[model samples]
Target: MLRRTLLCTGAAAITAVFTGSLWHGAAEVRPGPGRYGPLKVPDTNGLALPDGFTSRLIARTGHKVGGLTWHAAPDGGACFPDGEGWIYVSNCEVPLLGGASAVRFGKDGSIRDAYRILSGANLNCAGGATPWRTWLSCEEIARGRIFECDPYGERSARPRLAMGRFKHEAAACDPDREVVYLTEDEPDGCFYRFRPGDWGDLTEGTLEVMCGAGERVIWKPVPSPAALPRPTRHQVKEARHFDGGEGCYYADGVCYFTTKGDNRVWAYDAASATLGVAYDADSPLTGVDNITGAPTGDLYVAEDGGNMEINLIAPDRSVSPFLRLDGHGRSEITGPAFSPDGKRLYFSSQRGRSGKPTDGHTFEVTGPFRNLVPPQRA
Candidate 1:
């Protein structure tokens, strides 16, 4: 049942800035309609979707899908257009054996092929898609690095060490700014951006850490993106520290990211070099992890453990649960991305009902998402 009532909409009410310099403060943004309506009861697959939406299992860990054994602990993912069909790349968030895989779909939404895009990476967590159709697979380990993978499986994956050498979690490419924003999964991790020497070429780049507090922010070159002598975060004395940065996404001149430690969604306006808190712990959304936005201005944030659900943060800033995995209480929702046409969505349960990596399940939900209209203030 969708809530039709529209909440107040105006300037977000800033409440408090938790440490003055570290946090930009919390905001009470207005709530909007649950666009797709409330999630119905659990379906045949234990998924609660909207009225006209349905779910389908795409792949299960250790199971063969399109001739390839799906990897375990599926994490960050994205969809890329492939002619009349598309391809979905997902990360395997496992240590020692962590990697990433891709699944190709036909025009009829049928599985066409599945193959590996990246390998030999450890703790491959959340990552972002690039305009060039490459997937930035990030390794969430102490000495972890970023890998540029070809979603089409035409080229081999390569490590982009110049980006930085920390527990990298996610990357968001701001094509307009000619830089890629990244988030670290450390308790005191810092937000960063990598400026490649050549626009599409990420072979070499100058990694910089964010500094300052509040709306006005600045970037300072990271003494060593490789963290040779000192960790990148420690090298920048005045660099702002984020609480366990997780998923990241860039769109409409804003680079949006989530920090799981403090349960906040941050919006960095690249156009103005300003930063602000889009959502805080006070919102209905919690345990924020992987984030992705739609053409409709709706942002979908998956939960790591909060309710085993994917919540929608509407353009108006109102938050509500978009879908829920009914019986997978122990499991956390990972990747949440939409198809190129915006008619379908893809995501995964890192650890399914059994709470084991071997039981992970990647799913696809199809519905009338393309018709959603951003809620207006009442």
Candidate 2:
């Protein structure tokens, strides 16, 4: 599936207020320049951001913005461009009460109305945005599934049962082919693909598991998507298995995914039906989870545990730390998403050191990111 490359150009008009917002000191723990290079000491928050970067507090537990109170344990998030503004959809990783939330940010960086988008799920972990402008919130539980949501908080959060039932981790949509790639949360979970009959219409699709390695591959159609008698990998022989697969992002004819169990990042090239390791697990920066692509051809990987830092993978496969977390003990960085304009990078501290469910915070860092190539308005 070799698709056209999107070369974004121009820049968005940034407001002074967006660049001036900041949060107060979170903990006493001071962070130093990360392993890769020296980053400016954060003047306010606890996030160890790059030298030219600054962070703003989006919303924390108990905080109310638009009549709706903030939810606990913010996990995955995606930013959608709206009329002169953008909507940030966040996933709440609660037990049985897990769901997703949406917050609208004005062009001037002001927080507008916020509301609950999806409800009644379990462990709504990570998700992806569709070319049709919907958010696919994945539930990370056995027999769990994915629900497509409209960031406007208007559409029904209906589960597309054909996407398959498993411990889904995250999903990425290839706008070119209108296909969706999914990752599973189990150690031996199978990598999946959902091919919709009509482009951008997910109502009906074929569920398949990717098998084999390298350029030679196979797409094994799952016999039963709603209730698999066995794990997808066990059902299909010769299929490659991902250990604790977490997040995925599709770009440049490839789908890049992470495996926390093996601390590795894998790329599946749809054009050639091949699979390769973009970042080997042997690298010092392990516990790879979420992944996002920089317009300049580089890939950014968020840590699920080990170093608790965001790792940058160059096009040549070299690695560096983009940012690190110190005081947020054990909290892994999740949902590394860029604003439509590419200026604001949004991510969250899943368990923020307080060890309380109410401590997870969602923060937005603004800076001159390499991929800050402003996207064209839709």
Give one clash count per candidate, in the order shown. 0, 1
lDDT of 2: 0.76
After TM-score superposition, what is the CA distance of residue 85 in candidate 1 from its true location, in Å?
0.4
> To one decimal, what is the Cα RMSD in angstroms of model 1 from the true structure?
5.6
Residue 307 of model 2 has an lDDT of 71
- TM-scores of the candidates are 0.91, 0.87
| Best candidate (score: lDDT) | 1
Residues 10-121 of candidate 2 have per-residue lDDT tens digits of 1211111011011111111112233336655644668777767888878887778667788888888898998988989899998899999998989988888999999888
Backbone clashes in model 1, listed as residue pairs = none
Candidate that would win on TM-score:
1
Off by over 4 Å in 1: 1-27, 30-33, 371-378
In the range 151-188, model 1's lDDT, one tens digit per residue, is: 99999999999999999999999888899999999999
